[model samples]
Target chain A: MIRAEKIFKNFGDQAVLKGIDFTFEAGKTNLVIGKSGSGKTVLLKILVGLFQPTSGNIWYSDINLVSADKESLRKLRMEVGMLFQGNALFDSMTIEENIRFPLDMFTTKTLKEKKDRVNYCLERVSLEGNNNKFPSEISGGMQKRVGIARAIVLNPKYLFCDEPNSGLDPQTSITIDELILNITKDNKITTIINTHDMNSVMEIGENICLLDKGKLAWQGSKDEVLISKNEVLHDFIFASPFLQKLIENSK
Target chain B: MNLNLFYHFGNFVIWQAQIFKRPENGSMYYKETVRQMYDIGIGSLPIVFLISIFIGAVTAVQFYYQMAGSLIPAYYIGYIVRDMTIIELAPTITCLVLAGKVGSNMAAEIGGMRQKEHIDAMEIMGVNTSAYLILPKLIASLLMIPILVCAAALIGILGAYIASVPAGLFSSAEFIKGVRSFFIPYNVIMMLVKAFVFAYILTGVSCYQGYFVKGGSIELGQASTRAVVYSNILILLADYIIALILTA
Candidate 1:
């Protein structure tokens, strides 16, 4: 479990995250959902140590991430994995090499062992035979899967994904969501995903935190979403007339 | 402007400290260094050859024209060409050109990676992005640029031979005699010293510009331009300082 304690972030007098206190539970898809510019990305970045909060403590279990020293942070990073919004796979590397990068950098494994791990990751992502293909040669959905494979190749204890479904179609987005959900359950990893996709929120948002204008506005599960009385959550989740009408009709 | 200069200089010094840290994996750095060597060294051969030849030809031809009917012997053209190429033109001109070619390319490549969030991805994976990205390029330039400068000096002397000897401006023997006259081995050492310093400036400045780049493609383009411009200015400045120190 990862706990964020009174996290306050400010960029030159403009506060982005205002005293957000929350706990992301292990073995579940913990979602941070909000409209654009609602501090979702900033919160996620702070949690992953990409950005330091202006004030507050981030407890990755017992360790305080905000105060961890360099060596400690380095060790912690090995147990951490992230999937970028752009699916930041190395364009120059093949799918197999991309998946094997972490192992090659941080392991004492021999070439055969590394290759075996790479193959296993590829198979796990359901891109079993597409080892030699470069990222550009694959479809966007396939590239997302490759990103997932690379992220999980290290068997990280904590997984952070930033906007995993931004440019993907709804169908592909759902597939990616399911994949992440399964990976979290299978590995028992503490997974925190930053997304605004309602389909993702309704489908696999086992634990959800809603931010409105840099403050935590609502918090609940997918089941609580449809019946929630939180105005901010309602405005964000049912922003479109169609979604609002469907929610109303279903009620 | 003064404050901005100090800010950049201070940041650059701090960044250098980060870049020289111990590598996470020696073999990975070695592999990257080899790749960079091929890119910065072999990839630059054709352009270096073309420029060096012209530099030698022009220097010899211009000197010969000025020395015509003077007290100085025609053979001095070869000697002058040899000294100039080795002492100044070969290292300085070659590095200036490479600041535009290799330096700008390094900036763009790293800047593109930054814009694409590749660096962030590596950082999240526990890689020292600064050391991993810049060190290999630095090592490659340090090892390759001096060799390239030496090649340029030799090709430049050959170019002088081709332009002067065959054109009947002087006999081949006279030019050869002039080349053999001023055999000061110390000048070659000076040339190498300049090459090493210039190599460090170009690579470090370029990598620094790219690694800290922010925003979109336009910003990246500006960073690449700054990398080349700053590298050239510093190279020339260092060239003057080194010449003074060595000559003194």
Candidate 2:
């Protein structure tokens, strides 16, 4: 589990996150949903230790991530996996090389063992037999899966995905969401996703935190999304007239 | 101005400390250093060769003109060219050219990675990105730049021979005699010291500019430009300082 207590992040005079407090539960798909400029990315970056909160404490289970020393932070990083918005695969490296990078850097596995592990990770992401392909040669969805393969090759205890479904088609997006959800359940790892996809919220959002203008405006499950009386949530989620009409007709 | 200089100086010092941290994998660093060595040394050879040849030719021609009416021996032209190329021109000019070519390239490459979030990816993976990215380049430049400067010095002498001997500015024997005359080995030492110092300045300043880059493509381009500009300026500055200290 990861906990953020009274998190505040500022950029110059502009505040990006204001006193956010939340618990991301383990063995579950936790989603942070917000509109543009709602501090979702900043909050996610802070949670992943890419950004430091101006005032707050972040706890990874019993470890205080905020105060962890360099060595401790490195140990913590070994347990953390992140899938970036752009996939962040080394373009010059083949998929197999990319997937095996962390293992190569951190582990003393023999060549055959490393190759076997890379193959297993590729198969887990359904990217088997594509090991020799470069990132540009594959589709965006495949690249994201390769990114996931690389992220989980280390078998991290915590996984974070930023805008995982941003550039995928609806069908592909559903597949990615299902992949993340299944991985979270299978590994019982704490998984946090930053997304604006409503389908993701309704499908895999077992626990959701909604940020509005850098503040937590709503928190609930998918079950409460349609029934909630929160005007901001309603306006933001069903901003399209068609979605609003569909919800009204359903009611 | 002083405060700004102090600010960057402090940051550069801290950045060096980060870059010298223990490597996560020694073999990986070795492979990267070899790659960097090939890129910096072999990839840079053609341009360095082209420039050094011309520098030798121009120095010979200009000095020949100056020596034409003077009572100074025609052989002195070869001696002057040989000494100038060995003591100053080859190392300094070759490095300045590399400061533009290799330095800007390192800046753009690293700055692009930062913009693309590749550095963050490595950092999150328990990798000390500063060390991983910069150390190999440093090692490669330290080893390769001196070799390149040496090659540049030899080629420059050959260039002086080609220009002066073919142009009939002096007899081949006189030119050869002049080159063989007044050979001070310490001048070779001075040249090498300048090469090492300039190599460090260019690579360090370039890596520093790129590693801390922020914002988007526009900012990345600006960082690359700054890398080249700052490296050239610093290399020249170091050249002057080394010359003063060594020559004095």
Error of 1 at A27 (Å): 0.9
Candidate 1 CAPRI grade? high
DockQ of each: 0.91, 0.89
State what share of the real interface contacts each candidate retains.
0.86, 0.89
- Candidate 2 per-residue lDDT, tens place, B41-100, comes to 999999999999999988998999988999999999889999999989999999999999
Per-residue CA lDDT of model 2 for A107-156, tens digit only, reads: 99998999999999899899999989999999999999999999999999
Candidate 1 residue-wise lDDT, A118-212, digit = tens: 88888888899999999999999899999999999999999999999989999999999999999999999999999999999999899999999
Q: Which ten residues in a row have the lowest lDDT in candidate 1 chain A?
A: A238-247
Which candidate tops DockQ? 1
Worst 10 residues of 2 chain A by lDDT: A235-244
- Chain A vs native chain A, TM-score per candidate: 0.97, 0.97
Q: Candidate 2, A235: how far from true, in Å?
A: 1.8
Tell me how far the alpha carbon of residue B120 in candidate 1 is from the true structure, in angstroms, after superposition. Answer: 0.2
Structural similarity to truth (TM-score) of each candidate: 0.99, 0.98
The per-residue C-alpha lDDT of model 2 at residue A168 equals 97
